[model samples]
Target: MTRPQHFGWFLARGFGPQGWGYPSLDWDYDWTRPEVYQEAARTLEQAGFDLVIIEDSPSLGSPETIDLRVRHAFGGPKHDPLLLAPYLFQATRHLGVVPTVNPAASLPYTSARQFATLHHLSGHRLGLNVVTDTGSARHFSDAPQLGHDEAYDRAEEWLDGIRSLWHSWDDGALVADRATDVYADGSRLRPVAHRGRHYAFDGPLNALPFTDGEPAIVSPGGSGRGLGFAGANSDVQLALAPLHEKSVRDYRARVHEAAVAKGRRPEDITILFAIQPVITSSSEEADRIVAASARPDDAALQQIARKQSSDLETDLTALDLDRPLDLSIFGAHVSRGSIQRLIGDRGEDAPLRAHLTALARAGRLSDRTGFVGTADEFADLVEELGDWGNDGVLLWGDFHPVTLHRTLDELVPILRRRGLLRREYADGGLQANLRSF
Candidate 1:
């Protein structure tokens, strides 16, 4: 098989909003500016990217303020992202539309139908980002909380139910069999029944599928109970890790382990580490954009990385980095599950305080791993990643979810010269471009 080019794009107008190739959120100004957002979408479509996913979240536990030390960039769509998919997909061609949906937060039966409908409308250009939220149970909206384990258990059964529904009707299930006087083929349609502790449902999906199979499923990332859900059902691996090579390798390896632990083919799961992109004519120019005492933090260097504050921000800065981190400070912002992994990854001498400081010093923490060099260097980096082990990268940039304004001027041209990245997009959706290669 021809080696695949390994790179994709991610956008959450809330976090690293400006790094993408389009207009980012202006929390103080106008994120509601539809025309501005539309223009940005056009820019990305013209760039020949693989996909543009809309990220969503309902809570804002922390303030959107940035100190010189650190910030939480979480800017997102003010409206329902699902409603916007067909519009975004239609406004431009070849850009796949990925919409992040917390499985537990929404009803699967309804989602199954909506996604099936989306698949039809987009001509099979839709992809799903399945995020199983572990923070709080959504059993009750105004509802009660389901235990974490129970929630995962629900996801397992729910995923099975949805898949069965998606695949229920075969091609041409809607037959105009005049002789039989039947509008549809009853024998071809089947109902799926799945029973579990939290929920149970069974039925043939109400709609016919446009895609041959389920829209390529992407695991939005989770741990403990969540990993099992991802391994069994996901096709793409999603994560936010430090940009350093070691961090990328570690996440890819962990996700691969999850895939292998189950009976699933590990190759079916592609590891995608998120990076807030920072492109420039030269590496120095990129640095200049964020003029800071330290490396202008990736998203922190921008205005929005501060949509929420992790508890470690202030305390870690206050404590002596020379000392060490006290994991106890995570009482509210995080749980112990977030600690053991950090300790194991960083080693005993490396204290939690140091880790927090490092993250603050480098805002490129989540999705921090991306093209940081001149166009030529970045193009080579993308090529190198394919040689290494990455399936592709999910890129963002500071202040905006776009990385293009600089990329088009600096990187794309170089990539084209090298015959690596495309100079002109082929006529079709993002998948047609990807699968052909």
Candidate 2:
């Protein structure tokens, strides 16, 4: 029997109000309130998505100065996803809440305790997206920001410490029996004396054992270091859905090979590509919608510039948008992955200035790839990906409530009818749902 494809949503605008595709999103609406996100989580539960990955960053930059950050509200003023997870869990039963955690910023012992607590409370409907802080390391503390490889190396030790703490209290340690006047089996509990290059933890976690087993682990980075870590550790790996067939095959194969080398079956780790679907009632209508959404105006273009500058960690406001950009100046600060996707093979000796200028002019605020079509056509795309052995997709376009409802109400049913998506959730929480595929 063919396994049903797993589905998840990458909630890009956790609580942000401004983003592409949603023009009518209320700017004054309070993002701190639970109702804003709870409604979306409940909708996903109805859609039968396996999980919702919430992204966060402590170092939201002010690239073009305070005005840019305040004007765009791009990545700042963010609420803690941990505090918001409970609301989502309370709003829905099966939709797993996976929040990104930067190990460099949060201690492993604290992460373990918090995740374990959520696991117990949510019946194992929890996942942690381990992230090595890429933003300024100074923001995390006084510690210098380690290089990319070093960050992952430290993350490896951090994860080991967390696992040790989690296992400190063995199974069946909690025996609430009044007859013996004892609650926990003291002998079964042990302490984790973990001291590593980056972190040190001495003793057992001051928390109950995780209920319904360990919460699912998700790894999203695609760097070489990230691939190795994900292959060895993550239950699910989040990646960008490629635009070409060869890219898809190569990416999946590489990750599977990594898993195999690590003594893990390829099936043990599920890979979900990030996608956004532009759904409409008909092909022509979809095309018309796409056309309408295209060609953003001057104000929007400026916002895009601000956002790109923030990501590149350099202010491009003063640079001539039309002149050939001196690529040497950007240096290593430019994200290599972003460059590959945007420039592709056309970047060989090409002037880099036009690329950045083009991005701003085109109003390409985000790199999130999407399919614009009728529901049936979108289903075909999903089926094609599954046929290529891709596990599933993670959807997110805008933070607008309408987009979430339309995806759940219109696109989901089409996918279910075509047998490309699960019609109902599995018997347990997020982990069970992920394993069900």
Candidate 3:
């Protein structure tokens, strides 16, 4: 028997050009306008998705790599996702809108007040996709640049300060006495004075107290420190790992262990693994697609290089494909994990062509592991994960109507039939929707 699972959409490109690289760009919806995303949000709500997480990165990389970042519109020219959340809220009532926010870019007091206002306006449908990106610190004045672990430390302090401000108002702070014409009891507000290594602030937040609950905390970090942070503070963990049953169980156990260490129940946090399934029309078509990718030609290799270049902030297309890639070509700031992902299990002496060809190879759905499949095959994978005690799966793509429909159109009804997807949402905003199952 399959159990109902939570679903979400990851706006993988941030607020950048939607449909730019895809054929859907011909649809001609202005990426700067909100209508495209609004339509997408409504579609997600109708499909019973619980939330939409908008990805953001404030910087385009150093001057040397700016060309690689934006040449394909892969990384730069992004508007603020936080500014776009309200439009999504105005468009849908139950689906949560989580915009990526970095502590290094904004002060604690400002984040608390702004988030509090959106939380109220959205009726507690706001969520924060907290990120501790150290690369963009230079964009903010007087922001300190820290190492990886240190960055998480600063984020911890920043979140602590924000929570303190959110809780500054006491239980009786809002005593609206009708006869006395008093709107609030100022005496009941508690002052927040936070002095931490990364931040210093004082606030009895001017924003009103939350009637339902504070905005849900969503985090995407797989590191030890990242998992620890999720265990301690997050309500949703954006997870990524191999989709095998044992792998899923092991990963959930690690997260549960971390939560238990922090005195939190395992059920307190929803672990939604990130998956991007390639939906095909038929098994034969899926087989053809997988077969076509087995031997990538030079053109296919170049396209792969372009994407990898944007991600690593290094121009890989210019490198000699016949020679072993010089790992030192990557800058000091490039994430080690990104480099490892590009290399995979390939040997250190392997040529660049070998790496790109391995990446271009596709797997079949009959294997019950890889993502290339028809809707029914995809449903089989979802049901198998449910049997493994999976919490949910976050489908990744651009926040465009075409992308939403392309992925969910056939897959949705199939999952619904298997009792793997929700048909209706319960009230109480994002948290309630998450806890409904």
lDDT of each: 0.58, 0.73, 0.90
Considering summed lDDT, which 10 consecutive residues are worst modelled in model 2? 360-369
Per-residue lDDT for 68-112 in model 2, tens only? 554566556567777889888999888899987778777888888
Number of the top TM-score candidate: 3
Question: Tens digits of per-residue lDDT for model 3 on 325-374?
Answer: 99989876676677887998897799999999988988877796468999
Report the alpha-carbon TM-score of model 2 versus the true structure: 0.90
Ranking by TM-score: 3, 2, 1
Q: What are the clashing pairs of model 2?
A: 325-353
TM-score each candidate: 0.76, 0.90, 0.97
Which candidate tops lDDT? 3
> What would you estimate as the lDDT of candidate 3?
0.90
How many residue pairs clash (N, CA or C atoms closer than 3 angstroms) in each of the candidate models, in the order given? 32, 1, 0
lDDT of 3 at 194: 90
How far off is residue 231 in model 2, in Å?
0.6
